[model samples]
Target: DPAEAVPAIAPTTVEEVNTRFVVLAELYEHDIQDFHALLEGHEAGDERYAERVDISARAVKERETA
Candidate 1:
């Protein structure tokens, strides 16, 4: 799953900023788990699935640091 959270603008208000963070946090949490499950289900012969799992894992890592 692709996860993205975009506010109407650059989160100027306190509430909008907080909401954006909340949305991002939720997305990060869910995507990490979803990608892990996808990795677990990938078959040995499925090179494309393996590649995606690898890419997704890296994306999760990047999001974690961001």
Candidate 2:
């Protein structure tokens, strides 16, 4: 089920968002980098992993822009 798991950006109000994102980072830390970059621009419906990348990227962008 590891492959089925994907990182996501939780709502700002959700505490678990940080925890879950950390878990995802630990899990996928060595899995992919090029893949993540390639998928960052993808529409969520393109794939689950793609959605995860989008979510993660948006989270970073949101913070950076803030």
What does candidate 2's lDDT look like per residue over 1-66, in tens digits?
885697775557456778889889977875687568667757455787877899999999999999
User: lDDT of all the models against the reference?
Assistant: 0.84, 0.78
What does candidate 1's lDDT look like per residue over 34-53, in tens digits?
99888866754498778899
RMSD for all candidates, in order, please.
21.0, 24.0
Q: Give the TM-score of candidate 1.
A: 0.44
Using lDDT as the measure, which candidate wins? 1
In model 2, what lDDT does residue 31 have? Answer: 67
lDDT at 45, model 1: 46
